[model samples]
Target chain A: MDLDILINSLRNYDGITRKNFIRGATQILDETYNIGGRTALGFGDDASALDIGNDTLLLMAADGMWGRLIEGDPRWAGYCSVLVNVNDIAAMGGVPMGMTNVISVNKEDICNEIMLGIKEGVEKFGIPMVGGHIHPDTPYTALDVSITGIVGKDDVITSCGAKIGDSVIIGMDLDGRQHPKFPLNWDTTSHKTPELVQSQITVMNSIAKKHLLTAGKDISNPGILGTLGMLLEASGVGAIVELEKIPRNKKVSWDEWLKVYPGSGFVLTSKEENVKECIEMLQEVNITSQVAGIITEDKKLNLRHDNQEKVVFDFNHDIIMGIKEERS
Target chain B: MDLDILINSLRNYDGITRKNFIRGATQILDETYNIGGRTALGFGDDASALDIGNDTLLLMAADGMWGRLIEGDPRWAGYCSVLVNVNDIAAMGGVPMGMTNVISVNKEDICNEIMLGIKEGVEKFGIPMVGGHIHPDTPYTALDVSITGIVGKDDVITSCGAKIGDSVIIGMDLDGRQHPKFPLNWDTTSHKTPELVQSQITVMNSIAKKHLLTAGKDISNPGILGTLGMLLEASGVGAIVELEKIPRNKKVSWDEWLKVYPGSGFVLTSKEENVKECIEMLQEVNITSQVAGIITEDKKLNLRHDNQEKVVFDFNHDIIMGIKEERS
Candidate 1:
């Protein structure tokens, strides 16, 4: 395999390149993101954290599916909407609670399909899609869902909490197939039992409550390595990930596998001693996890495959979300 | 004023009538609204309340600006988006913490104007616009914003809390002009100081913390009387509102004032003994308040002007949102 070709393809992939825009957009709103002095964690995390009274924090996040996907499958768009929001809350180590969505569509049939998917997602995840305003008539189709969750101020796991010497681990369900319509989407929950899917969520909370991980994030859009890059950026840390060690299904190419939006996956960082327990807990719930790397203070994300190393993201010059979420 | 014509106009008004579609839409998803059983309050309230742990609740709400307003003035639409979300939180007697928006626009000029207005609004309300997805290219322009706030478990004030014999209080900033672009929009915050606008939000928290009000809601699309009707419906109660007693800007006719969307306005119900304190608290923030009516056991919204009382909405027969919003 040509390293140059691999690097260029990854750089041009919409999933990775689209993140560049997020960096610019987040910078413009940084000042207001912390207005009133209540924003505990702003951009660079799955959700923004706001401090409430009594050592409780509110985790809030919003996601809008790509228009292409909504046009292709409104039902999938709706289901993914819930899937993404729940992952956001789980990523924060916050107990997933409720969500609200605003969907605008021109066709009732599409709307019906979307709602059906949303209903199934809600029942499976056991989190409600409580209240929202719907635009019944619009020229195009769009769906956006925002969720709110609760976490103890001290127990919350943030993407910015990773520290040097922390072990980088990836936990993902390898028993998934590519969504026929959306190849980049790995549909895992569609085949899993509700109990199993919910267990996947509860385990994340258990890990957080146990104070096992120093930093973590749900794997999303940019996929495994890209997600790790974001967490490293947020924590102001770096890592050297062994590409061969990342859990994989083998049926898909590394390039495609690294980009699929998995149904249940997370990138976590735990101290050297806690890594074993963290992986064991996730594996008990069917999540295949392995220590993929070690966090470092180098400010560079080094990837090693076949003993050939490449810098995926160099924080010295690269900006993923451009927001350094490290609190200390 | 011709009562027939006035009533007909209001019934036909897009602001008042568009909500009629809400019931049909919300019904399809009501089963999922409480899927996880964490949703303490759902549809029809200013915000959805989620029961998080440690006796704290997360309030979430969404609002979409009228497309006509976005077309006429993107800036106003943007500003109103922030104002409306803040009111949603305040209506819950929760702190106006932060907001996220999904904006669909194709024109650069319109997007810039919207952002500028949002920036001004964020600074004015002292709340962050932390994260939102943008639809860069859509056939039409639309804006939907959702906010998350923290309210104590016991301190939350819901629209479903009214009871018989409660004094109905109407609070509004009766010091604004009709928007040139959107005549029905009562523009109060455009000329006010940020300090004053923020204070308007805090006063509601005071009433809630003091446990004075039985129920409260922010005045929205359906206008003052229309909004009051929903609150009464949600609380499983009714009211007899004296039209002449409703607060209004003298310059604007009674009908127009009642229909205008005030920058800061609310409808609250409290026991007779708590009326004075509620009124006093609202007045401190320049929100003119008065005992304009009284809650009753009947399910009819009766409006009286010149002793000729007219039954505007008989919940026993007519439906506003149609969904009874019975939070069991």
Candidate 2:
């Protein structure tokens, strides 16, 4: 594989580039992100956390379904809406309690299909879709869902805790197929039993409670390396990832496999001593795991393959989300 | 004013009629609304509550901006987004902790204006907007916000708790003008001090702590009578409201006043014995309060003016949201 070519493709990928808008928007409200002084984590994580007293933190996150996805398949969009939000909470090592949605669609049939998909997701995850607002006369179709969860204040995992020498672990459920309609979606949970699907979710909380990882984030639209780059940016550090060590489903090529959003995937950082146990616990839940890289103090994400190394993101110049953790 | 004409206009008002779609959408997800048995309150309330242990309930609610409002004025749409979600928590007698938003816009300038409005709202309410997702390449401009708050489990004031003989109280800040861009928006908080504005929010918590009201809901897009109609519908009961007894700003005609979405307005139900204390507490925060009606067992919301009575909504026939409180 041409390391330089692969690096460039991932760097210029739309999944990663679309995140540029976030820094500008968040910068506009920078002064008040923690106005009440109870914000334990904000802006740069999978979910923000507020210190709600009682040794507990409330985690909140929101996601907007891509318009193309909604138009092409409203059912999948709605189903993924729940999938993504629940993943956000799970990524933070919190047990998601409930979700609320705002759905705007012009057709009754489409809305019903979307709701059916949401019902399936709610039952699969064991979380409730308690309340929401619907705009039935809108000219466009859209779905936005927000979720809330709770975690022990000290047990909460953040994106900014990666240390210089920590081992980078990539975990993914490889027993899945690429969704035919949306090629980048790795469909793992749809056919799985609810017992197994739910166990995959609770495993994160178990890892959190055990203090197994220093930092972690779910692999999203930005793909695996891009998501790791975001964690690096937030942590003010970088990583040296051995491309071949990364876990992958054999059916997909390296380029496409790196970009696919798996139903259960996470980029985690842990002390070398904890890596063995973390990988073991994840494997018990059917998530294939491996130590793929090491964290570095240098602010650049370097990809190694075929005895060649290419810098995918030099944080000094390349910006993805561009938000560094500011909490002391 | 002819009572029949006034009633007909309110019945067909877009704000109230738009809610009809919610029933069908919610019905599709009916079985899982309380999936995990943690849901203490679900549909038919300002905010859904989940018993998160420790005698505390986590409250959540979401709202989508009207497409026309966003098209005409993105700033107000952004500000109202926060106002509406915060009010949802306040009406549930919870302390507003934090909010998350999903903003999809095609124009940079419009996005900036909307962010500015959100910033202003955050500072004004003293509640933080900690995190959000942005869809910068969408074909339309839309904003959806969700909020999380906390209240004691035993202290929650629900819309389903109104007793048959309870007095219906209408509380609103009558010292404001209609918004220049949106005539239906009663601009109360924009010109007020943050200290006073925030006090209005906390006063509801005080009432809840004291167990002053049997039920409550914030008046939203559906003006006074329309909102009252919804409350009656949710409570599985009806009300008889004396039109003139409802506190109002004299500048707005009865027709217009009944439909304006005030920045701070609420419809509450209290026992006759607690009416004096509830009104006194509301008055402390500059919200004008009055006993406007009485809850009844008959499923009809009747409005009386100048001794002529008219049925605004016969719950047996009319369906505003059509969701009755089903929690036994």
Candidates, DockQ:
0.62, 0.90
> Where is model 1 more than 4 Å wrong at Cα?
B105-112, B135-140
Give per-candidate clash totals. Answer: 0, 0
What fraction of the reference interface contacts is present in each model, in order? 0.64, 0.88
lDDT of 2 by residue, B188-213 (tens): 99999999999999999999999999
How does model 1 score on DockQ?
Answer: 0.62
As a TM-score, model 1 comes out at 0.94
State the local distance difference test value for candidate 2: 0.92
Q: What's the TM for model 2?
A: 0.99
Task: List per-prediction Cα lDDT, in the order shown.
Answer: 0.85, 0.92
Best by DockQ: 2
Candidate 1 per-residue lDDT over residues B1-328, each given as its tens digit:
7665666676666667767767776777877787766788899899998877677778899887777788888888888899999999999999877888877777767877887788788988899887776666667787888998878889999999999999999999988889987778998998999999999999898899999999999998889988898898788889998877888888998667768888999999999999998999899999999999999899988877776777778889877887666654
> How does each model score on TM-score?
0.94, 0.99
